[model samples]
Target: MTSSTDLRKAFAPTGKLRASINLGNPILANKNPQTGEPFGVSIDLARAFAERLGVDIELVVFDAAGKSVEAVRGEQADIGFFAIDPLRGEGIAFTSPYVLIEGSYLVPEKSPIHSNEEVDRQGIRVTVGKGSAYDLFLTRELKLAEIVRAPTSPTVVDVFVEQMLEVAAGVKQQLEADMNRFSGYRLLPGRFMVIQQAMGTPKSRGSDASTYLAKFVEEMKASGFVAEALHRHGIQGASVAPAA
Candidate 1:
């Protein structure tokens, strides 16, 4: 069995818990408008986990999910929140998801592509955030349609509009918000995927640390901590994941 001291050593070797936060996923995290600080469901969870380990917390923030995942995979940060993908699992040991978010596609209101299936046809170009979960998933799934990647998730729609791409793929809430920013766009009814948002530490942390983190996630869901945090953050279109 892994003792509490061993768990601390694995999680906070630098004497503080370093959490890699991605502001790209609006449902998980966002920046404070007035203070320029990180605050959201992911931030709240990071703080709570640090408190559980009885350590001070440090946020290693990034504007893109890929950068955040790299920080944890390279062990530059102790842990991070991410959408579960098999590619990322090579370096990171992920917990059962604590939040479930929808991934959807957006297109011009008059686009001939009315359904998710229609967007994959030849000559239809899609834009997604580089190194994002949807990007990874679509890379494997889309055979005929070309994928154009934006520098970050927040810019997916921007790139789509700027480049006149046929489709934009990203977090459903983000796509919905982008609809407001860029007129003449509509989301395909239903989702293309369900992104499993979870916490992860480097696989180097060992099975014990991974197991502990998994338990923590399950507890957060059962205790309604995850649900309350989402509500407090004013996030919509995401739900607490069921217990694992």
Candidate 2:
């Protein structure tokens, strides 16, 4: 077993654990209305990890997943919570996912699209947050539909509505909340994808750091910590990932 001193050296070389927090994914994180500080399951996990390492924490916040991933990949932050994707894996060493979020589509209620499968046909324009996990996945998977890039994940539905796009893809909870702002939008019958949300550090952080992070995630899941965080934050449409 790696000693706490060695673990701290690997994860918090700067003497503080810098965590990249993404506010765009409401299920993982969001601002406290009263305090304007980031809060949610991811924030809870980051704080717990810092406690385990006996280090102070610094939150490096971003409004989008792409920026958060880049912070860890560039070593601007020590760790981040992100949806696992192959493109991001090039520079990030990811632990098994700690949470699983559903990716769904939102469409105007009157639209003919009734299922996740129908959105991929020709002439369909799907809007997604630029450089987001869904964007990366759809960019590779969709052969006929056109994908429009919104400036950020939280803005995806806004872009879809403004542009009169056929579909908007993102975290199911986010899409559900965005639906209330419009009179005629509804989520499709089921999810298009299951996003594996995981903790990650820069690949340059070395194997010991990666192994320790992986173990931390598995323990969190097995001990009910992940589930408790979700319930505490009032998050919906996401679940604790199975122990890995």
Candidate 3:
């Protein structure tokens, strides 16, 4: 077992804990329009973790998941919320996922593609946020369709529509919102992948920090803190990930 002193030393080297907030992931976080503060399940979990560590918390905000990952990897922040992906595991240590989000594709209403399997055709062009989990996954999984990288995750839908791409792949919630915001677009029947939304700390922080964080996540999930946060934040479509 890791003692409080050791946990603090390993995870909070600067005597303070910083959490990176990625607004790109609407399931985990949302920007408060009036306060301009991020408040959502991830924010709640970060605050609670800081309290457990008995350290002051600071939020380093970013509009993209890639930026948030970079913050933790570079030690600009001690921890960050991220989608558990092998590409990102190089510099960061991830805890078991606290939430599971589906990754789906959106296509124009009149498009020939009627399902997720139809997306990987010879001439189809798919758009995704540059450096996003879907972008990384599809980059490897797509056999024939060309991938057009948008500037950020939040802008993937816009870029997809503007560029008239055949498919737009991203968080399922984002696609649903886009369907409401725009016309003539519908999500494919099911998800292409499940995004494991997790918390990560710099690998330089050591295994103790990693272990502590993983245990904390399991506790949060078992104790209903995660479910309550989801309800409090009015989040839907994301379920607490099963024990990892």
Judging by lDDT against the true structure, name the best candidate: 1
User: lDDT, candidate 2, residue 60?
Assistant: 96
lDDT of 2: 0.93
Number of clashing residue pairs in every model? 0, 0, 0
Would you list the C-alpha lDDT of every candidate in the order shown? 0.94, 0.93, 0.91
lDDT by residue for model 2 (111-187), tens: 99999989999999999999899999999999999999998999999999999999999999999899788879999
* TM-score versus the correct structure, for each prediction: 0.98, 0.98, 0.97
Candidate 2 ranges with C-alpha deviation above 4 Å: none
Q: Which 10 consecutive positions of candidate 2 have the poorest summed lDDT?
A: 1-10
Model 3 TM-score, 2 decimals: 0.97
Model 1 alpha-carbon drift over 4 Å, by segment: none
Candidates by lDDT, descending order: 1, 2, 3
Best TM-score among the predictions, by candidate number: 1
lDDT, residue 96, model 3: 92
- Please write out the lDDT profile of model 3 over residues 174-216, one tens digit for every residue: 8899888889998889899999989999998888789889999
Question: 24, model 3: CA deviation in Å?
Answer: 0.2
Per-residue lDDT, model 1, residue 152, is: 98
